[model samples]
Target chain A: MSAPVSGGDRLSAVRAGMAADGIDALVLRPSPDFRFLGGRGDGFLVVTMDGAAETADPRPYLPPGVRRVGVDPEMRVRELFGLAVDAELVPAAQVLAPLRLRKEPYEVAMVERAALAADSVLACAPELSWFGATERAMATRLRVLALEAGCEEVLSVRVTAGPGTAAPGSAPSDRVINPGDALLVSLSARWDGYCAEVARVFAVAEPPEDYDAVYSVVVAARHAGMAAARPGVPAAAVAAAVAQAVDDSGYGRFAAPGAGRGVGLGSDEGPRLRADDDTPLEAGMVLCLEPAIYVPDLFGARVADIVACTESGPRPLTTAPSSLPVLER
Target chain B: MSAPVSGGDRLSAVRAGMAADGIDALVLRPSPDFRFLGGRGDGFLVVTMDGAAETADPRPYLPPGVRRVGVDPEMRVRELFGLAVDAELVPAAQVLAPLRLRKEPYEVAMVERAALAADSVLACAPELSWFGATERAMATRLRVLALEAGCEEVLSVRVTAGPGTAAPGSAPSDRVINPGDALLVSLSARWDGYCAEVARVFAVAEPPEDYDAVYSVVVAARHAGMAAARPGVPAAAVAAAVAQAVDDSGYGRFAAPGAGRGVGLGSDEGPRLRADDDTPLEAGMVLCLEPAIYVPDLFGARVADIVACTESGPRPLTTAPSSLPVLER
Candidate 1:
């Protein structure tokens, strides 16, 4: 089984959750929540107080006089309409989300594998022929490498060079990479259904103006975030730790809102490392600690790595380079 | 603009649709419906009769007293719960599905580009070193080639060899391609937002037993389906034509349920070429005429191609070989 809960046990857990929430039945499509409950293939999984089963038509699995139904959040509107049953539909996340907050041992390993595959792509970046390639082409190469590294699916690959890095979540463009340009390459890939993310910064030929200083600050912030992730600590504390580091460096305003997020079946999940969230850290919780600083139209720096919160401390799933690597011409 | 409808026009069309459907507002995430309405990036789009805009939080855009809301079919349950709107939620497809049945000129062009790219990948299949490669490896190669050919996204790549093809929708696996095995490769890719699909069958150094006959029947069925697809013809008629061709060859029982489906913004859309769908095939509508015969535990043959219903006749976007192409040792 891929998760700690499987078969009858998984159904029992879901049923317990449903009863507590007063939900009559839980209807799930093929999504992270479904996978977390040990669901396989493209079918609807229906969980009632008495039984649980996967079917092409969930109506049959649902109770005859079902009053309320918790539907998959990822469900398409078209499918919701097809349900046709006269039941008040609610988001299944009410009961399922809390259950998925903590990762299982099997899930943690899957995340580590995905993280290592993504990290390996960055480890080989220096040897790639990147001098004259466009950001899109370079991103494509990295994706190919990620696939070759045994990633079952490559979610997204972002390659931003020079000014492009200043824009948050900038997509790969046709802009050619030039010497002295600051390149930020971030990759999110899935291995065996679990997702992990890794992002690293590099200078085309040499570090651009203020890049080294900014890069150092981002790295320090990532370290702080990692240190603050531990059992019993509030998720906001991790964000605060990252904020404090960037604030100390006087680049506080440039620090992004989300310091990191829980990662596993879904790239972004609960325990969001934001100032407003207070979800406590728990053992077996895997997270992508990304602290980024964008300085307007100028160059920016970001470093992301996966970490698993445990009783002992934070166990880093991916290794972040201590210093920025410059791709020599 | 990538689509025929631009800012004001797209919103106007959506507003018109909402008014007709008695929907006070529409909430769309990053989905095919969002793309069809010319939405970009990861943002929520809220459309009302009076105004339309994209935002991070859609609640502000929704009318305070709104009683009915149409949500994106692909919206997640979490997002659905977060909507917090006291309205009867419905699928937006009711209004949007019919509008998307016919493709605009620009949309058709994009679909054609995606089809050609997928076709090119199959065209070069003979040159690929597939003798010792696994089905998954070949699928990966096809995906990489699709990306190189400027496909913004590859929906899926199916590389089923030998008995695996008999299992419908069989995913690429680790099974090695042998000398006498039959290989089926299908690629669905999106170019500039529009999607198209292409599937072709091939023989190894030597054809498998009874493979040629089954493949010939499939080809004839595809031809019949294509010939039946025209302006003013019912979609079901086309499906019937494909069924008749397979039935004449005593392979009716083995024929897949869906002969094909409309291809464009969404990989699979309305005007479904099935016995149950009587939607008229209008000019400018693109269809993927796929006919297949799967003999349990033995072998199967499937040939899929894109055909656009023109004023005069069917315009094939993808070229399916008249006969199976044999990959030499």
Candidate 2:
């Protein structure tokens, strides 16, 4: 059984965040953010900025002094009204988003576990494959493996084959693998509430020279992006490094500009590794590196892995070998 | 394969909501609401309020004025940048909640299929009650039954026996069922995206008189709750009617107040059947009436079914016989 974290610790973390941000109170929307701060289960929690407040003390769970502004007009405002009598139930969208963008230690630990679980699933991939396996069968095996390895849920399992390789977010179908077909598998598993994403390419038969040449370039580009991850490093710099690597290898035209983003409690959050992103990487943040090059009507290749950011540099959390595609007869 | 609904028709429904609400735009968070409007996989959607003006030069497959918000802090603000952008990107929580609280014609069809799937599983419950049969074995068999009956997923299959009865929400374990022990089965199955929930009580041998008496009261209470579900009725009224039935039957001390809520696309939705809930019931809403009474150290009895409201009265969606406890010898 997993060591369930206490509700008190979660409440403390929310209080600490409110104090640091100087916000009078925090209104948690009904999402993963609420689950992260208010333990596991569905219900809303309003935390006051003050630390020394009891659950019965209605004064602490809302904006310190505001009296009228209700959070989202559409949300069940009456629920909040029942909890606290005095304070204004303000729109949490404006109050909660900025505070959630940053990460804390407990949040980082959850992300690390999510990544490790994804890595373990990928490491056991070879045993999961067989000839003439349908996309759904492969996905089922992966899901069962992830669950047995302690993952709370398999958020998504993408197994795309045949000529439809350009789309990254395609679902698994009944198609069977044939020789020379490129198989791209992307699996995301959740540990506790945090999510980890990883993708790998496989060859149905001996891969052609062109496929190997392209695979080498994509791998290099992924490492180039990983190297740029550091504390205070601009998100744009990482995107640029990956794009430049692909461009120099003559695959820029086919390469999707940005690779991936920061993975945490949600599948995608904070400091997205894209051209337009300017969020700076901070120590203890977790990120996913996915570089893709699509050739319409032919095939595409994408390699992704989750890594942790330390004061020293980026540390890869996934241990699946990234040298070449796993070719099956 | 499920027939994909036309994206254009879905977008029109969202646009109509925006016009009716007098809102400049709508921000859809990641959930069924985003899926219903965007027709895309998991992501956020921002739809502009202007209809004809925005539709004049519509994008090809993309909905007119519907912007796919990328992951960026400014993306939220940029989505509302021009044309009445000052109107906050308020969360679209209630739009789906109320709409989903009541079942649409198509949604009711899907939920009926899901409920039948649950019934089919219960039909085979006798075969699964062999000597030394573990909870996991029973759960696995029930899941297979649901899947074969065309359920996309078995959301939850809970079987509690002996000591497992004390703790709620526990997964199936390896504990073998012996003769003369009570078994409580709760299951929720999904067909397409819609879901239905059902629960039943079973005895390994002939149950005591008290068990049958308590079970009858629970079934009567469930029927009372279903009868109270009609257009313009408050949710609290339905809850109180159910609780009052149990209380009048001399089991008021064991009444657990609220029983269940609206069940449709998601297993749980709006107009919660709680004591404090005063949400007015609207026609086209489907709700699960589960009136349960738990007597500590003795027994717990519950009978649940899904019902949809019409202009005249409520219609039962699930056709499970809500009678005395099933004696499985």
Candidate 3:
């Protein structure tokens, strides 16, 4: 139930993809792509006209088998397998990354639950923030809540406060929370086999004018991305919509490309929101839009939430309040 | 300071390894192998007499450049690079994997700190056990403490109870902690870029005879693995010693080949404890011994700890008491 395509449906999807590319056999290592194929091993998976089976032991590629093409996303292992296994190794992302876009009922449920759990855990960020609270401690507390919310894994918690808020990194040390400092808490969680991300920016004291300006602009940009997202729309259109918001706000220079990315088994997978990628938005695709402004060792602002693409429009998966929170310590 | 081999020391080591094999103009993709070289981007690293520089963006293999005897680990990306770049692509692991064996002072310290943080959080597992406390809540609590201890990331937490404990997995759901259920809690934490792991088995109320027997044998096997782990010893020798303990306790079939493995910047790195690998253990090598026993759907037992190799002997880095804990309701 955790898989979008489910058992027989997945095999059918793989066969259709292989037929389109004229690929006979595939070799997958330990990746999210392999997980979609119902794999739970460090070894590689071999699929052919006959059937699919995992290698008994860990190896770089599938066992000796006749096939038109082999696929491996990682560069290191594929080379070793090319010499050992008899098959034409091809790039996997070109063939496999697209297979995970359309979600099944089970897969969609897992993603929604993951986003909800992540939202519940992140809601307590502002409460955990105060004088003397270390960024590391708050991040840990958030992850603990994520686990309690039924998440199998907490992907990453790069929440930072005070001087380290501008740069994206983790390892909350002795840097204490001080008044007027911007706090950035970014966390991702996994449920079943799906994943989602939630990011928030909080102000502990009277914020600077620049901070408010950046925060308001980023918020507008994020909402624009969400509004522009829907079935049949090109992915870049969403990015352009978000860019226009930032440009109009005078922070066009800070509008980074790839403002949003698809989230599921892989945090950065499927359709990438940029100017060039024109992959049309499809139902069942989950995307996270993160509009952030960085000034390098100075103040910053960022906000992110997971949104699901439906026939009607875009539905926000994470329900945590997205508004800027400026709390008085 | 995070790396064991600091600054120019790493390039010197890679150069030394390259010189022995008559290799020049090494091609490294974005991986822990390349990260060890102090890279900070998605692009591949091209090392030569000149220096190392990342690509403009993230790519599978090195870009075309004038150099002799290019080295790469992956075949697909190498083949693509071969078409794009101007050099011969040779394999990388045989030369690069061995390069990471020797640990520097800073790398060792980071690993030790990660182990200490992990151990402190897992120590409270016994106290958290109660009649009705859910496994999900307990796992969450453990992760929260790990973060507070200065861990930048929680790699994975596979905690299960009741019937699910026998099979390794997570999701702390509605599965209540009934008395006599075997609980397996496995957690890993990372500091800087170094990581360490710890696994413990807790018995609530009372345990079955088979569970007690498995726990005893696993603990004995872990100790044997630690005792045999030391500087100048073959990595497989420790595996053999652990195998003997399990076999003597009538659990030979359950003693897997990889009883322990190297831990550092990456969780699974360096020499693996099996019968084949003859890599000599050196001073400052951190290894984690995980001796486990799984009996299908009935019961299971596992105990693991991080041990650092030195001239004196193997020093236990993760100091969470390895004794079996039987908690009453």
Q: What are the models' TM-scores?
A: 0.93, 0.70, 0.80
Q: Model 2, B36-137: lDDT tens per residue?
A: 454344334556544322121122223344433211121222132222322233335534444445555777788888887787777677766545788877
lDDT of 3 by residue, A1-329 (tens): 12346567777778778778777777776667778888786666767655788884333333345556656564344334454645555665556777787676667778888888887777766566466777666666677677767787878876677657666544555677778888787878888778888888877776655777788888888898899999898999988998899999987776666678898887778789888989988888889888777767676677778888887889887643546687666
Q: Which lDDT tens digits does candidate 1 get at residues B1-329?
A: 12334445667777788888899998999888998886897989888887778898999999989999999988876787788888888888887887788777777888999899989988999999989899999999988888888788889999998888899897898999989888889999988888889999999998888899999999999999999998888999999999999999998999888899998889999888999999888887999999999998878789999999888889988868988889997
- Candidate 1 deviant stretches above 4 angstroms: A1-10, B1-15
In the range A191-215, model 1's lDDT, one tens digit per residue, is 9989999999999998899898999
Q: On residues B1-329, what C-alpha lDDT tens digit does candidate 3 reach at each position?
A: 12345567878877777778767667666555777888666556777655677774323333345444545454344345344544544666656777677687788888888887787777776677557877666666777677667687787766787668666544555677888888888888888788888888878888866787788888888899999998778999988988899999887875555787898877888788888878888887889888777777787777779988887898887643556688776
The TM-score of candidate 2 is 0.70
Which prediction has more favorable TM-score, 1 or 2?
Answer: 1
Q: Write the number of the candidate with greater TM-score, choosing between 1 and 3.
A: 1
Pairs in steric clash, model 3: A75-B74, A76-B73, A76-B74, A79-B74, A79-B75, A136-A172, B4-B104, B4-B107, B64-B85
Where does candidate 1 clash, by residue pair?
A73-B76, A73-B77, A76-B73, A77-B73
